[model samples]
Target chain A: MQKILNDKLVVTADIVLRIILYLSIVASIFFLGKMLLGPVLGITEYKSGLKTPIEFSVNEQGTATFGSNQTVPVNIEHAKGLFQIDRPVPKTLMVVFFLLNLIFFGLILWVIHSLWMIVQSVRQKNPFIVLNGRRLHIIAFSMIGIELIQGLANLIKMLYLEPRLNFETIIVHSKIHVSIHVIIAGLVILVIAEAFRIGVELKEEHHFTV
Target chain B: MSIRINLDVMMARRKISLGELAEQVGITQANLSILKTEKAKAVRFTTLEAVCRVLDCQPGDILEFIADEKNENE
Candidate 1:
């Protein structure tokens, strides 16, 4: 009698995508934790509010910028900080910060979208995503978009606010924090690359014919 | 999950060495070994196509579904 083990490509595309989606989510949580750790650890402080702990200070030209959350106390010599709010136009400047942060915010929306799609697939028990499904592409593009947004947001803030915002006075100054920010962003990109690898490479096989 | 592969019996029936099959299939002996030993995670359609061509037999000849003894007892 002949004997062999079953090989039915048990790993369906749905299962693969589900695994990748969950893996990405786990990586994202790690990212958020790493980004927020400094403030939680009391290594840095947000000067503006106790909740954020990031110190904002303005440069000689009267513009200030904010950094990732840290809670070192503020000492404004003649009142200059990480973010400079011109008394005359402080409302307009606040709006800019809100927009800048929110614009990059879409990446978070994309992440949520991908996770939701995975859950739907799981519930429906779809074996493989429909060819060119919107969810599949969103998962891929959203992850890539998240990395791009984080990197670009930092650059935008730096170009617009860095010179005007002097973080030199803060005990946990910008230098050490900025590098960690980049490293965490890089890890997110690496995970995104792995997701694409798993998604696009797997192929279906048909079982035996004479 | 319930499917089984019966390469061993087919090989015996055909009287061909695993090495010969590997050569005919143009796959590495190690990979062929994995398939023969049931350690393979997956089998490609091309590989299945190759196996059928080399053996001159249908896949059904090499794979079978005996109602499991455990299932029968139950």
Candidate 2:
């Protein structure tokens, strides 16, 4: 019967959601552990000593500068932007960067977990419940929050951190951009949440009708 | 609060049991119970016609309207 098929489909979707939820939780825990013990365990050395094709050398006066013998490709001029660093980044800065990344990942995991809860309700054939609408609203807002955090982090990197480095110069190929598409997608989800609320009201009315 | 179903009164007058009336009217017992208890929000014309046919009564005999004094005061 069609009812049996629908129930099976919902069960499968529930299983998939549970898998994703477990994965997100494990990833979040791993990131949290790394952030907590990274400084003490000398994990910062691996991240700070990143090797690149471009080399730097120190002069007799102890001034650090880029090596002139480095080969420059013709298309290098058309690259998005240039980021030059004179020295290795400090361990404290690396920890802060990791912390910011962890926060972003946490927000993403929260959105996924909210979706998982909504799907659980759907599997129970109660998709029109008020809690599902609230969960959808949470997902929409979390998506917008993630995009805002990403934009702010980018701005900080461009304005404050980049300028503080002595030999760092970023050639402006394009303006700093925020993802307008993500904001629009969040608005769409918000509208869908409102529609779900109205649907729940209508379903309740129908249930009471003869 | 204004519209009321008089299904139970008509069934009593006709001397018909709930199960007999529901079977003759081609509706479930639970649904007929809802109509008899006046708990239904609205009745369909087809269902009303079936019930009237089964009980040998007019539509007016099964449905009644009474105004609420609270609405008049408001």
Whose lDDT is greatest here?
Answer: 2
**Model 1 B-chain TM:** 0.79
| Model 1 per-residue lDDT tens digits across residues A13-126 | 446666766676676566444434322333343221111113343333333445866445444434322442332223343344444444445455565556566555545555
Displacement of residue A167 (Cα, Å) in model 2 is: 2.8
What candidate 2 gets wrong by more than 4 Å, as runs, is: A1-13, A33-73, A78-107, A117-134, A153-162, A168-177, A194-208, B1-21, B32-41, B52-71
Stretches of model 1 off by over 4 angstroms after superposition: A1-102, A130-137, A140-144, A165-203, A207-210, B1-74
Which model scores highest in TM-score? 2
Per-candidate TM equals: 0.33, 0.57
Clashing residue pairs found in predicted model 2: none
State the local distance difference test value for candidate 2: 0.73
Q: Is the docking of candidate 2 incorrect, acceptable, medium or high quality?
A: acceptable
Candidate 2: Cα lDDT at A9: 84
Candidate 1 chain A: 10-residue stretch with minimal lDDT: A45-54
- The best candidate by DockQ is 2
Which lDDT tens digits does candidate 1 get at residues B3-64? 67788788888999989988998988777877777656577879888999999999787666
